[model samples]
Target: MRRLASFFLALYLASCSGPYMGKDLFGADEFVLDSYKIREGKLSILEMEGYSVAELGDEDLEEYQDRIHEDDVLRIFLYHPKRHDIVQAVSEIGNSIGYQVVGGEISLPDISSVKVEGLTLGEAKKKIEDHYARHIQDMEVFVTYKDRIVRKVELAGLVSVPSVPVDGKIRLFDVLSKARVPTDANLFKSYVARDGALLPVDLNRLLKEGDMSQNIVMRGGDKIYIAEPSAASLMVMGEVARERVISLPSGFMSLRHALAEAGGIPFTGDRSYIQVIRGNICKPKIYTLSWEHVIHLPNDSLLLMPGDIVFVAAKPITEWNRFISQLLPAFGGIEFIGKQCGSWGIFVP
Candidate 1:
């Protein structure tokens, strides 16, 4: 009775025009496939694609929003236009309101950080001239980069990266703000690559939450890849009442739910030969199962993840025939979730 009850939960079904033993599964044509039975311990539920949270350290977080970086040379040159005298250089300026002498921090994994102080353009320059540089006839104090860091950080995706003037310390947040990234751009999947290696840049924290710890300073010759989320869906095809593409819900969607959404299977649809082809089209695996038979405990649900292409089959994976050429066109039409199918195509040799 327990076994029957488990099977009952796994599926519930009937015919083509009518309701249809229950509709299900899919397979690949021309593509050589290695098949495996649905194991007792390892089931469909175990293969769910979910988000994972990682713990990060904030040891190098900047107390200030922006700071000067390595190989940067800054100077305080007080220039008085009223008195044509050589711009007097100052050792240090006093602590006045606006932006204080900002000693920016450098973040280099290979070498030690070299800190440099810089000041923004404002009345503060005049204040410095008024108090110290020289009795101001005309407020003429200046702060400029003696040696500016000039290079391009290539950014790809929806964000249009402008030529950011690298005066001193340029951070990730600085670039993103000017990048004109769309509101719909998916930050979670974005990553930064440097020197042929991926940098540990969690854009979600920096962009969405305003987390300063993740706002690492940008370096020259860096490549940033930004991506948008794929259209969330599941493609259901073959031997069903209404073949359709179902939108992925916020929560889990089971085979039963999907079949129901497709208005159940017809008589032509095979109940014993249900095949669930998952993963990407280039390298995908097909799982064959019988909805009529008794499935194990937790596996009864048989939930489907986003982008999972649910299809029906006339025969099981083991009995898949190479002559089955009609499915080739349908399989090729499948669009993977957030990924390209690549160059490989399923064709008879």
Candidate 2:
């Protein structure tokens, strides 16, 4: 009975101990790092300067394809000896709602819905003349074709790198290289939108894709967006060298590179048992593994992706309370001596 009672006593003491507190000399739990706490309430992603890109919707791009003059072309007049007001009036009349201006002096009979994205005055007139021959009773207007610079286009997406304001006559490769399109760009399945329709082009079939040169003409307001590599991505959090989304590449990018991109763990990091939260579905599914194995093991080079949250928990605190408890008997003995000394001192007084 006594043995059983003693066993119960031990169990009770164990239950009474705090989760973090231990009788040992040290604890294994770690203190929290400020960085581990995410910004709460509202998250504002600040755009990086010269690194921001905008995407256009299909509806906005559809306005440029309606029927112009029977012959569609563009034209421009330089030093026509006309006042600026006259020039402006003519340009407005050509572009008005009821009339479509194809090119120099070529106006469609009915320009109900005609818009052009990239065309100078000379070119515009040619388009009008080519497409709306029946609409114009008299095509006698003569305007000079001055290929003047007009509107500009915007391109963004996964690239070898990222840049902004990449103006001038840009090719597909130039923009791709400028954007630093990720290696994971699906060359076999690429898409561009025109008039509310997404046109998929195969990068391998350049001619079929309408790619005349390795370089494709960049229209003003044209944006080239690269896509994420795959739907399956992993979150690399907790004491990692890198903390951003890692698009799985065709070739291998080791764990070291991922860590390097994450800025590596701070000096205060607990090197062992780096934590990775997988899926993060209903609850954060935690995985603990040593750094050595992750770095050395071939299977540990897990591909990372966007929206993966990586966290490195601090080192566990040592169980100093356990050691303190062991010294309790010694403290008890000291108390008795202290009491006796008090009595002796009193008697001498």
Candidate 3:
């Protein structure tokens, strides 16, 4: 009867046990938690693979020529070197006032109209000088650009302002300053898109290293995308006092500092087997470090990087207790089974 009772009890426990507990008992290597292993050196979330910084070339310079378009206002000043009367006559009629370019032509009062649209500032000045050459001898034409169509550059991601209006020539930093980019902006990954092609910019080099080459001249219709800082965070799990996700600040964080943030490992945790898991989900690089040895060596201190996971492995006794805790839910049916067996006089005890 005692052997029969032991056999039934063993069968009942086996039927109640879950596949997860069984795998744990069999020592199946499974990652129950996902985390990052922060490391030393520069960590970049932006894809810098197969990417190189583009140098400014002649083609880039040619794209910046500011040409006069329709609706552009020009302040024209005309002077006749030999004839003072002609200069006085033109100035008295308010000929020096703003003249709107319409249909590619700038009309002179009681004079011939000259086409100036699609021409650069220097080209337009020469065109006006040639027009007055036929009428006035030794004529000087001074063209001053007044109000024109507002040139805009689209700013997206992490900028306080979206659309920025530019006058004359503007640089990449000038637009960012005007937009008031936040401190957390991912400046290294920011880029400028022109003519459907993206040009990666290193704002950190321009700001910190004083690399003037990164300050690219901005043009009208250019789109600047300032990416927000990567959601760089680390998870501290296992035998820590508090298992939580800790957000990584800009710059480096040491393993000791990260452990302190997680409230340190509990007394029951094994300090000799601190595990740091890294890499992709399917194939992860597992590293085991002894806290005792690491604490003694200054150079051996692990610096946490973005998306790192620090796990303080628990002691074997604590793991056994955890295993037992998981099986507690299965024992809820024990009382019902005992009562049925008692009614049938099966002697459940």
Candidate 4:
């Protein structure tokens, strides 16, 4: 029952959606759109996409209402063509009361205080509505901060394209298309980083699985770094000095270099052979490379890619049995043995 409960809990945690999962787990800095903080007063709750809001108190709400237009970047979007007069009136009201249009335009109101800058047609309507909601009596306002533009972006692991810029309006597809991402950019294993933390993101799931909800919208000043193909390499479970993720430097690195980076081999490691397992398919390609050959022979250096698992297996059972036999006599005595094993046994066992 305990195991079953744990299984369900694990499944539930694993199945959580991107946003519900803690933000700390996402690596939006690298092709991730999760790290952006919308400057306050710029856009209303309805306008910003892909963000869940925190609770707002009445005092905060009142302050938001009192804020001047310049305090935030307004995005107004207009729908009806016949509402030019409303837009005109809204512009006049905004200008009369120290409200400036950073972007977008309305029918020329004779107000000299406010200037219309870079607003889209939809953004224009939103600005007009916002003006009415705050200052004008019996006026209506409607604004939204939906992703209005899309641009290209790209990601390369350590050896390839490592920098992915997220500026203006960008889509996930645009980012991947920007640079020649290596084949090792695993869709499932990829992550995003932001604010000095790592967050998990599904690159393969987003691209191949077509999960529209995870198709994040990019904002300005966002960054994404594709981890080095060697950085995400798998550990050799059966043997190897250190069973951990090994990050390789950029450039033409080889398989032998990876083994060296992982502290070479343990004293118990089999010096005769090392193996690499590729892919999860039925017929996993298994390659044998000699430690001496890999170190000295230039032709034996095979370039390691991301997610490759290298194993430097332990010596054969026959050798382990011999070693055990050599220690059997030492284990039989109960008195002198205890003295000899005192600190050594405590540390080892």
* lDDT to native, each model: 0.51, 0.42, 0.65, 0.45
Residues 1-349 of candidate 4: C-alpha lDDT, one tens digit per residue: 5875586457544543211122322121221121121111112211233234343223311211112222343333333355567566654554454232344333323223233344443555455555554544444444433223322233435324544555444555566656555666543335444344433344554555565444455433345665544444455443556666665322123666667667777766776657665444354445555576566655223554444567675665534555556555645664465667784764322
lDDT of 1 by residue, 1-349 (tens): 5874465334321112211233332332211121111111112212333223333335324333333344455455555555444342242321121122234632211123323333343433444554543334554556554555566677888778644544336777888788887766655456777689666566665776576777766756777776765434677777678889876422235567777888876766667655666776765656655655214313224655556776675433212332234345544554441135344553322
lDDT of 2 by residue, 1-349 (tens): 5875586457546544222222321111210111111111001010111113243334332324222233343343212243455445545544443232344233323433334434544555555444434543334333432233343444445554434432345545555555655555644334444345443332323422444333444444455555556532345555445556665432123445566667887654566645544333454334444567456655323432233444565443322344446656866886788788887884311
The TM-score values for the models, in the order shown, are 0.37, 0.34, 0.60, 0.33
What would you estimate as the lDDT of candidate 4? Answer: 0.45
- Give the best candidate by lDDT: 3
Ranking by lDDT: 3, 1, 4, 2
RMSD of 2: 13.7
TM-score of decoy 4 = 0.33
Lowest summed lDDT window (length 10), candidate 2: 40-49
Which regions of candidate 1 are displaced past 4 Å? 1-73, 76-147, 150-154, 163-180, 183-189, 200-222, 228-237, 240-274, 279-309, 314-349
